[model samples]
Target: MTLEQLKIGQRCKVKKVLAQGMLKRKLLEMGITPGAEILFRKVAPLGDPIQISLRGYELSIRKVDAKNISVEIID
Candidate 1:
């Protein structure tokens, strides 16, 4: 599933990011790479920026950006 589809409190393992070109490179630069663990924290009031826990911290990403990231559900 895609990161944008994860519900609040759900945990997932990063599979890969489908974005290409500069967009994909940018995401990788932000520490979003394969094999990372991610937890959905909360969604913005408007549901645009979704807060997620990653690498021992929280980072908010827009829905569009999250869509580029795919993940495997974790128990």
Candidate 2:
């Protein structure tokens, strides 16, 4: 499933990031890589950006970008 599909407070393992061009590079630079563990923290008030904890930090990734990230839901 995609990161955008994960529910809030859910934990998932990043399977792969399907983003391309600068977006992909940006995500990589932010520590979002394949096999990384991600925990969905909360969605923005408007649901555009979703807060997630990854690589020991919290990141606010937009839904559009989240769609490019695939993850396997975990406990």
Candidate 3:
């Protein structure tokens, strides 16, 4: 499933990132990569930007961007 599909507090591992161009590069630079583990942390009431824990850091990403990330539930 996509990262955007993750519910709050769910943990998952990155499978593949489907984004392209600069956005893809930025996501990679933010430490989101294949095999990386992620924990869904929080989301706005409106559900746009979502917070996640990755590589021991908290990262906030847009729901649009999250959609490009494929993940598999871990726990």
lDDT of each: 0.91, 0.90, 0.93
* True-vs-predicted CA distance for residue 59, candidate 2, Å: 0.5
Error of 3 at 7 (Å): 0.8
Candidate 2 similarity to native, TM-score: 0.94
Q: Show model 3 residue runs off by greater than 4 Å.
A: none
What TM-score would every model get versus the actual structure?
0.92, 0.94, 0.95
Residue clash pairs of candidate 2: none
Candidate 2 ranges beyond 4 A from true positions: none
| Residue-wise C-alpha lDDT for candidate 1, range 1-75, written one tens digit per residue | 899898899999989999999889988877889999999999999868999998898898999989999999899
Clashing pairs in 1: none
The digit string of per-residue lDDT tens for model 2 on 1-75 reads 899888889999988989899999998889889989999999999868999999899999889889999899987
RMSD values for the candidates in order, in angstroms, are: 0.9, 0.8, 0.8
Give the lDDT ranking, best first.
Answer: 3, 1, 2
- Model 2 gets an lDDT of 0.90
Q: How big is the positional error of residue 11 in model 1, measured in Å on the Cα after superposition?
A: 0.5
**Candidate 1 or 2, higher TM-score?**
2
Of the pair 1 and 3, which is ahead by lDDT? 3
Candidate 3: count of backbone clashes, pairs at least 3 residues apart or interchain: 0
Which 10-residue window of candidate 2 scores lowest in summed lDDT? Answer: 27-36
